[model samples]
Target: MKKAAPVKESGLGMMPANSNSWNIETHEQFLLSELLPLVIGYAKGNRHPSSAAALASFITLSTVLQSEGFTRNSLIASIDASRMDIHNAPEVLQ
Candidate 1:
Protein backbone atom coordinates (compact mmCIF):
# COMPACT_ATOMS: atom_id res chain seq x y z
CA MET A 1 0.00 0.00 0.00
CA LYS A 2 1.11 3.55 -0.71
CA LYS A 3 1.86 5.46 2.47
CA ALA A 4 -0.68 7.84 3.91
CA ALA A 5 0.15 11.35 5.10
CA PRO A 6 1.96 11.59 8.42
CA VAL A 7 -0.23 12.75 11.29
CA LYS A 8 1.32 14.99 13.92
CA GLU A 9 -0.13 16.78 16.92
CA SER A 10 -0.18 20.58 16.91
CA GLY A 11 -0.09 22.41 20.23
CA LEU A 12 -3.62 23.76 19.98
CA GLY A 13 -5.48 20.46 19.99
CA MET A 14 -4.83 20.17 16.27
CA MET A 15 -2.75 17.66 14.34
CA PRO A 16 -1.16 17.43 10.94
CA ALA A 17 -3.16 15.55 8.34
CA ASN A 18 -0.74 12.50 8.46
CA SER A 19 3.16 9.84 9.78
CA ASN A 20 3.28 6.44 11.08
CA SER A 21 5.11 3.61 9.41
CA TRP A 22 4.36 -0.02 10.10
CA ASN A 23 4.89 -3.51 8.94
CA ILE A 24 3.13 -6.31 10.91
CA GLU A 25 5.10 -6.44 14.15
CA THR A 26 4.85 -2.70 14.85
CA HIS A 27 1.31 -2.03 13.71
CA GLU A 28 -0.12 -1.85 17.24
CA GLN A 29 2.64 0.51 18.26
CA PHE A 30 1.82 2.77 15.34
CA LEU A 31 -1.84 2.79 16.35
CA LEU A 32 -1.29 3.48 20.02
CA SER A 33 1.52 6.00 19.58
CA GLU A 34 0.34 7.78 16.44
CA LEU A 35 -3.28 7.12 15.53
CA LEU A 36 -4.63 7.29 19.06
CA PRO A 37 -2.97 10.66 19.55
CA LEU A 38 -4.40 11.92 16.31
CA VAL A 39 -7.85 10.86 17.40
CA ILE A 40 -7.36 12.56 20.73
CA GLY A 41 -6.36 15.76 18.96
CA TYR A 42 -9.46 15.67 16.85
CA ALA A 43 -11.56 15.13 19.95
CA LYS A 44 -9.88 18.07 21.61
CA GLY A 45 -10.32 20.28 18.56
CA ASN A 46 -14.02 19.53 18.30
CA ARG A 47 -15.49 18.56 21.63
CA HIS A 48 -19.17 19.03 20.93
CA PRO A 49 -20.65 15.62 20.26
CA SER A 50 -17.20 14.25 19.51
CA SER A 51 -17.10 10.87 17.82
CA ALA A 52 -13.50 10.14 18.56
CA ALA A 53 -14.26 6.70 19.94
CA ALA A 54 -16.17 5.71 16.86
CA LEU A 55 -13.60 7.22 14.55
CA ALA A 56 -10.77 5.41 16.22
CA SER A 57 -12.67 2.18 16.21
CA PHE A 58 -13.49 2.55 12.54
CA ILE A 59 -9.92 3.25 11.63
CA THR A 60 -8.69 0.32 13.67
CA LEU A 61 -11.23 -2.09 12.26
CA SER A 62 -10.48 -0.91 8.77
CA THR A 63 -6.78 -1.45 9.24
CA VAL A 64 -7.37 -4.95 10.54
CA LEU A 65 -9.59 -5.80 7.61
CA GLN A 66 -7.00 -4.53 5.16
CA SER A 67 -4.43 -6.78 6.76
CA GLU A 68 -6.67 -9.79 7.29
CA GLY A 69 -4.69 -12.00 4.99
CA PHE A 70 -1.49 -11.67 6.99
CA THR A 71 -3.41 -12.02 10.24
CA ARG A 72 -5.18 -15.18 9.16
CA ASN A 73 -2.01 -16.71 7.85
CA SER A 74 -0.22 -15.95 11.08
CA LEU A 75 -2.96 -17.59 13.08
CA ILE A 76 -2.89 -20.64 10.84
CA ALA A 77 0.84 -20.90 11.25
CA SER A 78 0.58 -20.82 15.03
CA ILE A 79 -2.07 -23.50 14.87
CA ASP A 80 0.26 -25.72 12.86
CA ALA A 81 3.16 -25.14 15.24
CA SER A 82 4.22 -27.70 17.83
CA ARG A 83 1.67 -28.10 20.59
CA MET A 84 2.50 -28.38 24.26
CA ASP A 85 0.41 -29.47 27.22
CA ILE A 86 0.68 -26.33 29.24
CA HIS A 87 -2.40 -27.05 31.28
CA ASN A 88 -0.29 -28.29 34.19
CA ALA A 89 2.57 -25.81 33.74
CA PRO A 90 1.39 -22.91 35.83
CA GLU A 91 4.88 -21.55 36.45
CA VAL A 92 5.72 -21.36 32.78
CA LEU A 93 2.26 -20.04 31.92
CA GLN A 94 2.59 -17.30 34.46
Candidate 2:
Protein backbone atom coordinates (compact mmCIF):
# COMPACT_ATOMS: atom_id res chain seq x y z
CA MET A 1 0.00 0.00 0.00
CA LYS A 2 1.18 3.50 -0.77
CA LYS A 3 1.87 5.77 2.19
CA ALA A 4 -0.45 8.77 2.52
CA ALA A 5 1.10 12.20 2.00
CA PRO A 6 1.70 14.25 5.12
CA VAL A 7 -0.86 16.94 5.76
CA LYS A 8 0.50 20.45 6.10
CA GLU A 9 -0.34 22.71 9.03
CA SER A 10 0.96 25.97 7.60
CA GLY A 11 -1.06 29.10 8.58
CA LEU A 12 -2.93 27.03 11.19
CA GLY A 13 -0.90 28.27 14.14
CA MET A 14 -2.29 31.80 14.21
CA MET A 15 -5.02 32.77 16.68
CA PRO A 16 -7.30 35.74 16.28
CA ALA A 17 -6.39 38.61 18.61
CA ASN A 18 -9.88 39.27 19.94
CA SER A 19 -11.15 35.73 20.11
CA ASN A 20 -14.10 35.41 22.51
CA SER A 21 -14.83 31.90 21.37
CA TRP A 22 -18.06 30.52 22.82
CA ASN A 23 -21.13 28.69 21.70
CA ILE A 24 -24.36 30.54 21.30
CA GLU A 25 -27.41 29.22 23.09
CA THR A 26 -30.01 27.46 20.97
CA HIS A 27 -32.62 29.83 22.36
CA GLU A 28 -30.58 32.77 21.13
CA GLN A 29 -30.32 31.38 17.61
CA PHE A 30 -34.02 30.62 17.62
CA LEU A 31 -34.91 34.09 18.77
CA LEU A 32 -32.65 35.62 16.14
CA SER A 33 -34.22 33.59 13.38
CA GLU A 34 -37.69 34.61 14.48
CA LEU A 35 -36.80 38.27 14.81
CA LEU A 36 -35.15 38.44 11.38
CA PRO A 37 -38.28 38.22 9.27
CA LEU A 38 -40.17 40.56 11.51
CA VAL A 39 -37.34 43.05 11.25
CA ILE A 40 -37.31 43.05 7.49
CA GLY A 41 -41.08 43.11 7.23
CA TYR A 42 -41.53 46.01 9.58
CA ALA A 43 -39.53 48.48 7.52
CA LYS A 44 -42.68 50.20 6.33
CA GLY A 45 -44.89 49.58 9.32
CA ASN A 46 -46.66 52.30 11.25
CA ARG A 47 -44.80 51.29 14.37
CA HIS A 48 -41.16 52.20 14.45
CA PRO A 49 -38.58 49.48 14.07
CA SER A 50 -36.88 48.48 17.27
CA SER A 51 -33.49 46.75 17.12
CA ALA A 52 -33.45 45.73 20.77
CA ALA A 53 -34.12 42.09 19.96
CA ALA A 54 -31.87 41.95 16.92
CA LEU A 55 -29.08 43.77 18.71
CA ALA A 56 -29.31 41.38 21.61
CA SER A 57 -29.15 38.48 19.17
CA PHE A 58 -26.11 39.95 17.41
CA ILE A 59 -24.33 40.55 20.71
CA THR A 60 -24.93 36.93 21.69
CA LEU A 61 -23.83 35.65 18.33
CA SER A 62 -20.79 37.92 18.42
CA THR A 63 -19.73 36.50 21.74
CA VAL A 64 -20.08 32.98 20.46
CA LEU A 65 -18.21 33.72 17.27
CA GLN A 66 -15.40 35.39 19.16
CA SER A 67 -15.08 32.51 21.60
CA GLU A 68 -14.57 30.25 18.59
CA GLY A 69 -11.41 32.26 17.80
CA PHE A 70 -12.91 33.74 14.69
CA THR A 71 -13.29 37.30 13.40
CA ARG A 72 -16.42 38.42 15.22
CA ASN A 73 -17.37 42.01 14.57
CA SER A 74 -17.10 41.49 10.83
CA LEU A 75 -19.22 38.38 10.99
CA ILE A 76 -21.93 40.10 13.00
CA ALA A 77 -21.86 43.12 10.75
CA SER A 78 -22.05 40.91 7.69
CA ILE A 79 -25.02 39.10 9.13
CA ASP A 80 -26.76 42.38 9.81
CA ALA A 81 -25.98 43.60 6.32
CA SER A 82 -27.12 40.31 4.83
CA ARG A 83 -30.52 40.81 6.37
CA MET A 84 -30.99 43.82 4.16
CA ASP A 85 -29.61 41.93 1.18
CA ILE A 86 -32.04 39.10 1.89
CA HIS A 87 -34.94 41.52 1.96
CA ASN A 88 -33.87 43.04 -1.34
CA ALA A 89 -33.43 39.75 -3.16
CA PRO A 90 -36.45 38.88 -5.29
CA GLU A 91 -36.04 35.16 -4.66
CA VAL A 92 -35.40 35.52 -0.95
CA LEU A 93 -39.03 34.96 0.17
CA GLN A 94 -39.75 32.41 -2.48
Candidate 3:
Protein backbone atom coordinates (compact mmCIF):
# COMPACT_ATOMS: atom_id res chain seq x y z
CA MET A 1 0.00 0.00 0.00
CA LYS A 2 1.15 3.54 -0.67
CA LYS A 3 1.92 5.54 2.43
CA ALA A 4 0.07 8.76 3.05
CA ALA A 5 1.87 12.08 2.74
CA PRO A 6 2.99 13.86 5.88
CA VAL A 7 0.90 16.78 7.01
CA LYS A 8 2.44 20.22 7.21
CA GLU A 9 2.73 22.00 10.54
CA SER A 10 0.34 24.88 10.84
CA GLY A 11 0.61 28.53 11.99
CA LEU A 12 2.55 31.36 10.34
CA GLY A 13 5.31 29.62 8.34
CA MET A 14 8.25 31.35 9.99
CA MET A 15 9.03 34.20 12.29
CA PRO A 16 10.93 37.30 11.26
CA ALA A 17 14.55 37.60 12.34
CA ASN A 18 13.61 40.06 15.06
CA SER A 19 10.68 38.08 16.40
CA ASN A 20 11.21 35.61 19.21
CA SER A 21 7.96 33.68 19.49
CA TRP A 22 4.37 33.30 18.29
CA ASN A 23 1.76 34.04 20.90
CA ILE A 24 -1.62 35.67 21.39
CA GLU A 25 -0.10 39.14 21.23
CA THR A 26 1.85 38.26 18.12
CA HIS A 27 -1.26 36.86 16.46
CA GLU A 28 -3.31 39.92 17.30
CA GLN A 29 -0.55 42.23 16.13
CA PHE A 30 -0.17 40.37 12.87
CA LEU A 31 -3.90 40.37 12.24
CA LEU A 32 -4.15 44.09 12.82
CA SER A 33 -1.09 44.89 10.78
CA GLU A 34 -2.13 42.84 7.79
CA LEU A 35 -5.89 43.32 7.83
CA LEU A 36 -5.93 47.09 8.31
CA PRO A 37 -3.91 47.64 5.16
CA LEU A 38 -6.21 45.31 3.21
CA VAL A 39 -9.30 47.06 4.51
CA ILE A 40 -7.91 50.46 3.63
CA GLY A 41 -6.91 49.36 0.15
CA TYR A 42 -10.34 47.85 -0.51
CA ALA A 43 -12.05 50.99 0.69
CA LYS A 44 -9.84 53.17 -1.48
CA GLY A 45 -10.72 50.99 -4.42
CA ASN A 46 -14.41 51.78 -3.77
CA ARG A 47 -15.35 48.19 -3.07
CA HIS A 48 -17.17 49.17 0.10
CA PRO A 49 -19.75 46.39 0.05
CA SER A 50 -17.21 43.70 -0.71
CA SER A 51 -14.73 45.04 1.82
CA ALA A 52 -17.25 45.41 4.61
CA ALA A 53 -18.73 41.98 3.95
CA ALA A 54 -15.35 40.34 3.80
CA LEU A 55 -14.13 42.11 6.93
CA ALA A 56 -17.21 40.99 8.82
CA SER A 57 -16.77 37.42 7.67
CA PHE A 58 -13.08 37.53 8.50
CA ILE A 59 -13.74 38.84 12.01
CA THR A 60 -16.26 36.08 12.62
CA LEU A 61 -13.96 33.37 11.31
CA SER A 62 -11.00 34.76 13.24
CA THR A 63 -12.94 34.68 16.48
CA VAL A 64 -14.05 31.12 15.85
CA LEU A 65 -10.56 30.01 14.87
CA GLN A 66 -9.02 31.65 17.92
CA SER A 67 -11.53 30.01 20.21
CA GLU A 68 -10.84 26.65 18.57
CA GLY A 69 -7.04 27.17 18.72
CA PHE A 70 -6.60 26.99 14.95
CA THR A 71 -3.54 28.37 13.18
CA ARG A 72 -3.62 30.61 10.14
CA ASN A 73 -1.80 28.12 8.01
CA SER A 74 -4.26 25.35 8.80
CA LEU A 75 -7.18 27.62 8.02
CA ILE A 76 -5.72 28.61 4.67
CA ALA A 77 -4.82 25.05 3.81
CA SER A 78 -8.27 23.79 4.65
CA ILE A 79 -9.93 26.49 2.58
CA ASP A 80 -7.71 25.81 -0.37
CA ALA A 81 -8.33 22.11 -0.18
CA SER A 82 -12.07 22.68 -0.03
CA ARG A 83 -11.95 24.95 -3.05
CA MET A 84 -9.95 22.45 -5.04
CA ASP A 85 -12.31 19.65 -4.13
CA ILE A 86 -15.28 21.70 -5.20
CA HIS A 87 -13.65 22.71 -8.44
CA ASN A 88 -12.75 19.16 -9.33
CA ALA A 89 -16.05 17.64 -8.30
CA PRO A 90 -18.67 16.60 -10.87
CA GLU A 91 -21.48 18.99 -11.65
CA VAL A 92 -24.05 16.83 -9.90
CA LEU A 93 -21.98 16.90 -6.73
CA GLN A 94 -21.72 20.65 -6.97
Candidate 4:
Protein backbone atom coordinates (compact mmCIF):
# COMPACT_ATOMS: atom_id res chain seq x y z
CA MET A 1 0.00 0.00 0.00
CA LYS A 2 1.24 3.47 -0.82
CA LYS A 3 1.61 5.85 2.12
CA ALA A 4 0.01 9.27 1.91
CA ALA A 5 2.33 12.23 1.82
CA PRO A 6 2.53 14.53 4.82
CA VAL A 7 0.58 17.76 4.49
CA LYS A 8 2.79 20.78 3.96
CA GLU A 9 1.82 24.07 5.57
CA SER A 10 0.96 27.03 3.36
CA GLY A 11 -0.69 30.43 3.81
CA LEU A 12 -4.00 29.21 2.48
CA GLY A 13 -6.39 28.22 5.30
CA MET A 14 -3.39 27.31 7.45
CA MET A 15 -2.88 28.99 10.83
CA PRO A 16 0.45 30.63 11.37
CA ALA A 17 2.86 28.87 13.72
CA ASN A 18 3.59 30.95 16.78
CA SER A 19 6.85 30.35 18.60
CA ASN A 20 5.91 32.57 21.53
CA SER A 21 3.27 31.87 24.14
CA TRP A 22 -0.10 33.60 24.09
CA ASN A 23 -0.16 37.01 25.72
CA ILE A 24 -3.35 38.73 26.74
CA GLU A 25 -1.67 42.12 26.54
CA THR A 26 -0.61 41.51 23.00
CA HIS A 27 -4.05 40.26 22.06
CA GLU A 28 -5.66 43.32 23.64
CA GLN A 29 -3.25 45.54 21.80
CA PHE A 30 -4.13 43.92 18.50
CA LEU A 31 -7.84 44.36 19.14
CA LEU A 32 -7.39 47.99 20.06
CA SER A 33 -4.99 48.78 17.25
CA GLU A 34 -6.50 46.80 14.41
CA LEU A 35 -10.00 45.43 15.00
CA LEU A 36 -11.59 48.09 17.19
CA PRO A 37 -10.87 50.94 14.79
CA LEU A 38 -12.48 49.08 11.95
CA VAL A 39 -15.56 48.31 14.02
CA ILE A 40 -15.80 51.90 15.20
CA GLY A 41 -15.50 53.21 11.69
CA TYR A 42 -18.22 50.85 10.55
CA ALA A 43 -20.52 51.93 13.33
CA LYS A 44 -19.94 55.60 12.54
CA GLY A 45 -20.61 55.13 8.83
CA ASN A 46 -23.65 52.93 9.41
CA ARG A 47 -25.21 55.10 12.15
CA HIS A 48 -27.69 52.48 13.32
CA PRO A 49 -28.31 50.61 16.56
CA SER A 50 -27.95 47.32 14.73
CA SER A 51 -24.63 48.53 13.43
CA ALA A 52 -23.48 49.02 17.03
CA ALA A 53 -24.62 45.52 17.87
CA ALA A 54 -22.80 44.19 14.84
CA LEU A 55 -19.70 46.00 15.99
CA ALA A 56 -19.89 44.17 19.29
CA SER A 57 -20.34 40.91 17.46
CA PHE A 58 -17.36 41.72 15.30
CA ILE A 59 -15.25 42.33 18.37
CA THR A 60 -16.26 38.96 19.82
CA LEU A 61 -15.60 37.20 16.53
CA SER A 62 -12.26 38.94 16.21
CA THR A 63 -11.24 37.71 19.64
CA VAL A 64 -12.12 34.18 18.63
CA LEU A 65 -10.19 34.56 15.39
CA GLN A 66 -7.18 35.88 17.26
CA SER A 67 -7.21 32.96 19.66
CA GLU A 68 -7.37 30.61 16.69
CA GLY A 69 -4.33 32.28 15.06
CA PHE A 70 -6.31 33.64 12.15
CA THR A 71 -4.92 36.57 10.17
CA ARG A 72 -6.13 40.18 10.09
CA ASN A 73 -7.34 39.75 6.53
CA SER A 74 -9.64 36.97 7.68
CA LEU A 75 -11.21 39.24 10.24
CA ILE A 76 -11.58 42.05 7.73
CA ALA A 77 -13.20 39.74 5.20
CA SER A 78 -15.56 38.41 7.83
CA ILE A 79 -16.65 41.91 8.85
CA ASP A 80 -17.17 42.94 5.24
CA ALA A 81 -19.22 39.84 4.48
CA SER A 82 -21.35 40.44 7.55
CA ARG A 83 -21.97 44.03 6.50
CA MET A 84 -23.00 42.87 3.06
CA ASP A 85 -25.39 40.35 4.52
CA ILE A 86 -27.01 42.99 6.69
CA HIS A 87 -27.37 45.48 3.85
CA ASN A 88 -28.73 42.83 1.51
CA ALA A 89 -31.36 41.48 3.85
CA PRO A 90 -34.93 41.54 2.50
CA GLU A 91 -36.88 44.69 3.26
CA VAL A 92 -39.56 42.60 4.96
CA LEU A 93 -36.95 41.27 7.36
CA GLN A 94 -35.70 44.72 8.25
lDDT, candidates in the order shown: 0.50, 0.52, 0.59, 0.59
Query: Stretches of candidate 1 above 4 Å error?
Result: 1-25, 48-94
Using lDDT as the yardstick, the better of models 1 and 3 is 3
Q: How far is candidate 3 from the true structure (C-alpha RMSD, Å)?
A: 15.8
Model 4 steric clash pairs: none
Candidate 3 clashing pairs, residues 3+ apart or interchain: none
Across 1-94, the per-residue lDDT of candidate 4 in tens digits comes to 6743323332323656464424334477778898767777767778856567665776766765675677888666655654766557444222
Candidate 4, position 90, lDDT: 42
lDDT of 2 at 53: 50
Best by TM-score: 4
Error of 4 at 7 (Å): 16
lDDT minimum window of 10 residues, candidate 4: 4-13
Question: By the TM-score metric, which is better: model 2 or model 3?
Answer: 3
Candidate with more favorable, higher lDDT: 1 or 2: 2
Candidate 1 clashing pairs? 5-18, 6-18, 6-19, 7-18, 7-19
Q: Any idea what lDDT model 4 has?
A: 0.59
Candidate 1, residues 48-94, lDDT tens digits: the string is 33476656666665555444444655444443442544344334231
